[model samples]
Target chain A: MRDPFRSICDDDLERRWIWISLILAFAMGGLLGLYAVASNIHPPSNVETIDSSRLHLTEEFAEDKLGVKQNDDGSLTVTMVAARYGFFPPVIEVPSNTPVKFRIASADVLHGVHVPFTNATAMIVPGYISEINTSFPTAGKYSFLCNEYCGLGHDSMWSRLIVVPESTQGK
Target chain B: MNYSKAASLGLANMWVAFTFFAFAALLGLYQVIERIDLIPALKSPEMYFGSVSTHGVLMGFVLTTFFVAGFGYYTATTSLKQDVWNRPLAWFGFLLSLSGVLMAAVPLLTGNASVLYTFYPPLMAHPAFYIGATLLVVGSWAWCLEMVMMLATWKKANPGETVPLAMYGTTTNAILWFITSLGVTSELLFQLIPWSLGLIDTVDVGLARTLFSWTLHAIVYFWLIPAYIVLYTLVPRAAGGMIFSDHMGRVAFIMLLVFSVPIGFHHLYMDPFHAAGWKFLHMTGTFMVAVPTLLTGFTIIASLEVAGRLRGGKGLFGWIGALPWNNPLVLAAGLALLMLTFGGFGGMINASYAMNTMVHNTQWVTGHFHLIFAGTTVIMYFAAAYYLWPKMTGNALYSTRLALTQLWLWFIGMLVLTLPWHQLGLAGQPRRISSTPYDEELVQSWLPAEFAMIAGGVILFTSALMLVFILLKTHGNSQSVENPEVEYAESLHSTQRMPHLMNSFGFWVALIVVYMVASYGYPILQFFLLDTYGTVPWSI
Candidate 1:
C-alpha cells in the first residue's frame, strides 16, 4: 500500500527550499546593513547652535526649542525653556553651513528630535539636553518632529530649521 | 425566548460584521498601497486619513463589537441549549449598533473625523462621531446583559450541572466587557459627547484619557476571547484530537478575564496622570497574563501532538507532520498559532516598561497589532466561517481548494505586510501619516519597504476577493447538501466529570475583582490626588 504520510518524509527538497529562502532573506538583510554602514554620513563636525528652516511634523516635537544659539565674540550661550507638549520657537533662522551649538531638552515628556531631511534624529528626554553638533549643509527648509506619542496635541508639535544663504545674512 | 430565531438573528449580525470587516480589509489594502507611494494617484492626505480612520473604526470597533455580540448571543442560545430570553431586545441591540456605524461613517467618509481611530481628545472629532461610537458600545451592553442573564437562567434551570466550556468562556467575556467598557462609555457619554457638542467648557483631557485607559486594555482581551473560544472548543475537534485539558481552558479563560484589565497601564507608561508605582503594578499583571498564554500554548500543542501521534506519527515532534493540512480549521489554527507567537513577542516588548520606548507609537506598534488581530484572530475567524458556512446555509462550501488558498494568502500577505513594517519601525518611521512629504532621507529609506508592503496588500486583496467570491457562491448554491455535524475532539483521557473550578465562574469572578482592585484602585486615585504643574511627573 502506498502510504499517505510518505510525502512528509520524502519532501526533503521542499524543506531545503524553505531553508534556502530563509538564508537568502538573511543575506539580503546583511547586504542592506553593509550598505548603510558604507554610505554613512556624519552630523555637522562642530557647531554650537544650528537653526535654519521651517519644518512641518506629522506629530509634535517635545523639544522646548529647536536648536541652540551661540554668541559673536566667543561666548557659548544656551537658552532652555518650557513648552506644553510641543516644539516652541518652531522656526529658527541661522547662517548657511555655519557651526552653531544647540542644547535641546524637553519640558514635558520624552520627544524624538527628527530631522528627516538630514538623516539626523535623537531622543530628547525631559530635563536632559541632547546636544547635536551639526551644520546645515544647504540653505533649505528643513523640519523637525516628535516621533513619540506625547499627548493629545501631539500632531501640532513641529519645528523648522531654516538655513539662510551665508551671503544673505547680516545684510 | 427562541433558539432558532436567536441563531438566525445573531448569525446575520455576524455576517454584517464580516461584511464590514471585508470592506475595512479592502480599504486597508488601499491604505497600505498608498503608504508605499506606489500609487501616485492615491496620495491625498485627506483621502488617506479618511480611509485609515474609516478602516480602523470598521475593523477595530465595528467588526469586533458586532461579531462578539452576535457570537455571544449564538453561544448563549446553543451551549445553554435554551432559547435567547429576549429576541426583540437582541434585534434592538443590532439596530442600534448598525445605526451607530452608519452615523459615524458620515464623518469618517467626509474626512471630518480624521482624528484617527482613537478619539483621544483636544484633537476633537465631530460630535456625531463620538455619539455614534457611544451608541455602538451601548448597544453591545444589551448583549452583555443577555449573556449574564442567560447564564444565570441556565444555572437556575440546571441547578448543579456544570456550564459547558463554550458557554463558560462566553460568559467570562460578557462579564469582562460590561465592567471594562464602562470607563470608556462614561468618557464618551459625559466628557467627549458634551465637549464635542459645545455643551461643556474646557474638557478635562487628563481625566478623559484616564477613563479611556481603563477600557483600552480590557477591550483587547474582549476581542481576543472569541478567537480563544474557537481555539479551545473548535480547533482540537477540527484537528481530530481532544482538548488536552478542560481545566486548562478554564484556567486560561479565568486568567484572561482577571489579568487582562489592570494591564492598561502599559499604554500609559509614558503618559502623565498615572504614577510609576501603578504602572509597575500593571506591568506585573501584564507579564502575569503571559503565564495563561503559555499554558494555552502548551495545552494546545499537546492536544495537536496527541492527534498527530494517533494518526501514526513515530517520533516526539514528528506528529507535527501527521496533522491534517487541508481542513480549514486545522490549517488556520496552525497558521494562527505561528503568527500569535511572533505577535505575542512584539506585544511583550511593547508591554515591557523599559523597552516600550523603542517602538511606542512607531510602525512597530501597528505591525504588532496587525499580526495579532488580523493575522492570528481574523484567520481563525475565517476558519470558523468555513466550518459554520455549511451549517448556516445548509449547503456545501463553494470550493474547499479556494478557501484553503485564501487562508494561505492571508497568512503570507500578513507576513509580507508586517515584517517590513516592523523593520521600518526599527529604522524610525512613525505610523498614522499621509505621506513622507519632506524628509528625503527617511522617505528614501522607507520606500523599498513600502513597495514590498504594496505587494503584500495586492496579495491580500486578491485573497479577500477569493473569500468574498467563495462565500457568495456558497450562498447562491441551490441544492441543500448534507454535511456531517461538526465534531469537537474527545480528550485522550476522558473522564465522567470536570473539576469544580473548571466548570464554575463564581470563584474566578471574585478573584478578578480582588486582583483589579488591588492593582488599579490606588493607581487611579493617585492621579487626582497628586499635585503637579504644567507637566505631570508620570509622563507616558
Candidate 2:
C-alpha cells in the first residue's frame, strides 16, 4: 500500500498552524472586549432628561415614550418603554457629540434594550425602569429593533436613533 | 411482504410528498416576490398570507412527515430481517394522513385559513384546518406505535444481541417524535378546537400561547432527527467507511430526546405570558442541547477522516478529498454539514439569552431556518431518495449526472437565496408581509437581493422539476433485472458485541426520564406557582 496517510502523517506542521490560529483569534477577541470597556468609561458629552409623565404611553407604546428631538442644549433624551416583547418608543433623536440618558421601563414583557452602534445594552422588566446613560459620538442614523421575538409583528417593530450635528439642530 | 411491493409503496408515498413539496416551493418563490411588492399585480395581502402559510405546511409538515413514515416503514422491515409489523395498519395510517392533507388543502387553497400555521390564538384559522392537522398528526402516531412494537419484537426474538445501528436510530426518532408532538396535540384537541368551533367565546390567550410554545420549538427536532439519522447511519457507510463511534450516536440521540423538548421557552423569550426566570431556565437547556451536536460533529468528521485515510490520501485534511464525492450520499452529507456550521451559528445567536434581541424577527431568523431545514435537512432527503431509488425500483437511475446536477443546483440556489436573505434581515426586512411598498429608499436597496433570490428560486424550481423527472423516468423504464440488496457500510473498527448500557433499551429510557425531569420540571412548575388572573395559563 502506497502510504495512504501521506498528508495526514505531516501532523507536526498542521498542529503548529492550528495552535497559531487559535492564539490569534483569542487575542483579537480580548482586544475587542477591552476596547468596549474603555469606551464605556470615557463616555460622550451630550446629555438630556426625559420626563416619563409627559408621554402618552401604555404597554403597546412603551418604547415610543421618548421623542427623538433635538434640545437647545445640544443633548438628546432617548426615551424608551418595554412593552409586550420589545421597545415601545423605538426611535430616539439626539445631537451629535452629546451624552444622552435613555430612561426605560416595561409595562408588560421583559426586553433587552440594545443600541448596536453605541455597544450599549440594558435589560427591562415589567414595573421596573432601567436607564442607559450614553452619548452618540457620531452623526448618523442607527436603528433599534426588538431583538426579542415578541409576537407575530416582532420583525416589523423597530425604532431609529437619529444623531444630528449640533449645528443642524437650531436650523 | 415482497421487497418490490414494499419498495413501490414507499417510493409512491415519497413521490406524492416531493410533488407537494415542489409546488409549495414554487408558492414560496412567489411569496418572497410578493413581500418585496416589486410586482404590483401580486399585491394581495390575503392571498399572500394564505400562500405563505400553505407553503410552510406543505414543505415543513406534510412533506417531511409523509417521507419519514413511508421511508421508515420500508427501512425498518428490511433492516430488521422481517416483514412490517402490521401492513394493513400502516396503510390505514398513510391514508388517514393523506385525507387530512387534502381536507386542510381545501381551506388553504381557498384563502380561508391564513393564521400562519402557528398554534397561536387571537389569530384563528378555520375549524377544518385544525381537524385536518389533527388527523395528520394522529396518522403519524400509528407509525410511531408500529416502530416501538417492531423494535420490541426484534429484541425479544434476537436475545443477547444489539439491534442494527440503522434500526436503533430510526426507533429513537420514532420515540422522540411521539413524545415531542404531544404538546401540539393537546393544544389542538382541547384548546384550538373549542375556540375555532365557537364553543368558547374567549379562550385564555396566555395559556394557549404557552401550550403552543411547548410544541413550537421541539417540533423542529422532530423534523431534524431524521436528518441526524441519515448522518449517523447512512453517511459513514455511503462514504466507504464505518461509523467512528456507535456510543456517540447513542448519546446524541439520547440528548436530542431529552433536550429538544424542554427548551421550548427560547421561542417564548418575547412572549408576555412567560416570566423571565422560566425563559432563562429554558435558555440554559437550549445551550445544553449543543453538546450532542458538537459530539455529532466530532464523530462524523472522524469517520470521514478515517475513510479518507483509508482511500490512500495523504496530508492533514488532504484526506478530505480522497473520500468519494461522486456518491450522492457522500455529496449530500458534505453539503449538509457545511450548512450546519452557519445554521448552527444562527441557532447559537438565537439561543443566546441576550443576543437573540438583535436577530429575533429579522431576515436573519428566516435565513437561519432555511439554511437548516431546506439546506441541511432537505439535502439529506435527496441523498436518501437517490440511494434508495434504484434499490426500490429494481432499475438503475435514469441519470446520475442529473442527480449530481440537482444536488449542486440545490446547494447553489440555497446560497443565492439565503446569503442576501441574511443581509436583507440585517438591512431590516420583516418576514411575514404582502408588500414592501413603504420606505422606497429602503425597498430599492433590497431590490438587488430580491432579484438574486428570484434567480435562485428559478434554479431551485428547475432542479426540483428535474428531480421529479428522473424519478418518473426510473419508474417507467422496464428493466427486468433483479435489484441489489441494500448494503450498510462496515465500520473502520469493528466489534462483535457492545455493553448493555450502550446497546440496551432499559437504561436509555431511564436516562431520558431523569434528564427530562431535571431540565423541564422547574421551568414548567414556575408558571403554576406564579399567579395570573382569570384564565389558567396552559402548561407544556
Candidate 3:
C-alpha cells in the first residue's frame, strides 16, 4: 500500500547538516556560559537581607546614608532603596574608571534595577540586598529603572546614573 | 462512540476557546491604544490593568486549556480508533471550566482583581478571583485524567501495538501539564486563597514567587505541545509527506516533559528569593530544553523538504517553492518555524544567567513571549482549527482564500508588533505599565516604536476578527459538500514494535520526579527553614 505521508530517506548531506547545526547550537551555548563566568558578568553574590517593613528605621538604609560614599577600602558604595514609585537617591553620581558596588534593596515589593547599555543590573527584593560590582569606562549620563512590575507607577519608575570623569573623581 | 459524536464534543470545546480568544484579542487592541494615549476614553488605569489581566488569563489559561483538551479528545478518538473513555465525564469537565471562567470574569470585569495575571503577592486580588482560578485549574485536571485513562485503555485493548504518534503526544502533554500545574496549585491553595480571604494577615512573598516560578516557564511548554503535535502528526500529511522519523518525535516529546519542568527557575533568575547557584542550575536545564526544539525543527523541515523534492522540484532549495503553499497547515508550519528561529534566539538571551539581567521584566521579554505564544503556537492553533472545522462540520470551508490571507496577516502583524517591542525594551521601556510619560527625552525616543506597535496591533486585531468571521461562516454555511476525515501523517519507517522505554511513560515519569525533587527541593525548603518574613496583604 502506498502511503501519501511517507517521505524519502534523508541523504548523507542532509544528515551532515543536521549534526553540524546541533553541534554549533550547543557550542554557542557553552561559549556564552563560559563568557559569563570568566568575565564575572552575573547576578551579584553579596547576599544580605533586611526587614522590609522597617527599612526606614535601619541604620544601613538611613536617609543620610542613601547616596554614593567613598568606602574605607578606597572603593565607592552606592546604597539606594527601591520603593513604590521611585528609587531613593533618584540621582546618583559615580566616578568613571573606578569600580563601584551598588547595594540596592526594595522597601516594599519586588523591584529590579536595570541600567541600560551596561551590565549593571540586579533584583531588588523587599528583604534581600542585591550587590553588583561594575565600572563605567566612559563618562556619561545613564538612566536606570525598576524593570519589574511593582504597581501602576512601574513604567515611570526610574533613576539616573551620572558618571563623571575620572580626573574629577572626588567631586 | 461514533465519529460524529466525538467531532461534536471537540467542536463544542473549540467554540468556547475561540470565543475567549476573540474577546482577549479585542482587549489587547484596547490596551495598545490606551498605552499610546490615543483615546481619552480608554485612559483609565484601573480599567487598563483590568483589561490586561483579563486578556492574559483568557488567552494564557482559558483558551489554551480548552483548545488543548478539545484537540486531545479528537486526536485520541481518531488515532486510536476508539471512543473517549467517559464522554459524560468529559462534558462535565467542559462545563466546570466554563463556569469557572464566568466566576473569574465577574471580579476581573469589575476592576477589583487587577493584579495583572501574575498575581504576585503583596499585591492581592479578591477572594472570589482566587477561588474561581482554582476551579478552572481543577476542571483542567479532569481533562488530564481523561486523556491519560483513554490512552491506557487503548493500550490494554491493543496489546503489543505502539501508541499512535498523535495519541502519544497528547498523553505526554497530559502528564506534563499535571506535573507543571502542581506548583501554582500549591501556591493558590496554601497562600493566595488564604491571604485573599483575610485568613492570613501576611503572606511570604518569596515563597509565593518561588512556587509561581515552578509553573511559570513550564506552562509555556504545555501551550506549545499541541502546536508541536499538529506539526508532527498533521502538518506532514497535509503537506503530502510523512513524519521524518517517528522515534525522533517521541524523543522530542519525552525531552520536553523531562527538561521543561525542572527549568522553571529560569523565570526566577531575576528574583532574589532563589540563590544564583540554583538559578545557574535551572539555566543549564533551560539550555537542554532547547535541544528538543532543535530536533523538532530539523525533523519537520526535513519532512517538508522531502515532500517538495517528491513533487519534481529541482536544485538544492527549489523544493521549497514546489510544496503546497495553498494548504493552510503547510503555510502555517513554514511561517511558525521562521518565527520560532527568531524567538528562540531571544529565549537564549533570557536563559543566560547574565544576559537575563539586560532584558528581564523589559518589553523585550514581552516581545519574546508574544513571538512564541501568539506567533508560533497560536498560528498553528488557527491552522489546526481551519483543518478540523470542515471535518467536524461535514461541510466545505467558507473560503480558503480568506484563510490563507488571514494566516499571512497574522505572521506579518506578529513580526511588526514584537520586533519593535524588543527595540523598546532595549530603549529601557518596562512592561505591565499603562503609560510611559516619565522623562520627555527618553519617552520621545520610544514614540516611533510605540506607533509601529499600534499599527501592528491594528493589523492583528483586524486579522483576529477575520478569523472569527471565517469560522462562524464555515460553521453556519448552507452549502452541502463532501467532507474528508482527519488524516494524520505516517512515519517514513513504520514500527510494529518498540522498546518499553520509548513506548511507555513509566520510566520517564519516575525519572522526571527524581529530577524535579533535586532541582526544587532545597530552594523551596530554605523558605521554611530560615526565618522568612511575610508582608501583610495589600489589595487594590
**What DockQ does candidate 3 have relative to the true complex?**
0.37
Error of 2 at A112 (Å): 13
Model 2, docking class: incorrect
lDDT of 1 by residue, B299-369 (tens): 68777887788788779788999998899988998999999999988987777655555575668888999
Residue B299, candidate 3: how far off, in angstroms? 0.8
Docking class of 3: acceptable
lDDT of 2 by residue, B1-540 (tens): 467656866876788788899899889878777776677887776777778789988988898888888678778877787777887888888889889899999988887776667744545677898899999989988889888888899989998887776777778778777877887788888878887787865444445556666777767777777778778777887787877766567667777777777778776554444545566567667766776776677678878887888888799989899999988888888998998888887787777655554555557778889998999989889888887788888777777788889999998888888888888766666555556543455668878988888887887887888888887887765763355577765544443555565565566667666765765566456445544222211211
Best by DockQ: 3
Order of candidate numbers by DockQ, starting with the best: 3, 2, 1
- Provide the interface RMSD of candidate 1 in angstroms, 1 decimal place: 12.6
TM-score of the second chain of model 2 compared to its true counterpart: 0.94
Q: On residues B1-540, what C-alpha lDDT tens digit does candidate 3 reach at each position?
A: 357877888998899999999999999998888997767776777888889999999999998999998898888898898988898888898888888889989999998788878886787788888888888888888889988999999889989899998988999999999999999999999999998888888888878888888898889999999999999999998888888777778878999999999988878776666777787788778888888898789889989987888887789999899899999999999999999999999998888887777787779999999999999999999999999888888778999999999999999999999999999988878777888766678789999999989888999999999999999998998875474577889887666656667788999999999999999999888887867778876555
Cand. 1 TM to true fold: 0.79
Every candidate's lDDT: 0.70, 0.69, 0.85
Better of 1 and 2 by DockQ: 2
Return whichever of 2 and 3 wins on lDDT.
Answer: 3
Fraction of the true interface contacts (Cα pairs closer than 8 Å across chains) found in each model: 0.04, 0.01, 0.33
lDDT of 2 at B482: 56
Residues A56-84 of candidate 3: C-alpha lDDT, one tens digit per residue: 88888888879988978778999899888
Candidate 1's displacement at residue A48, Å, is 30
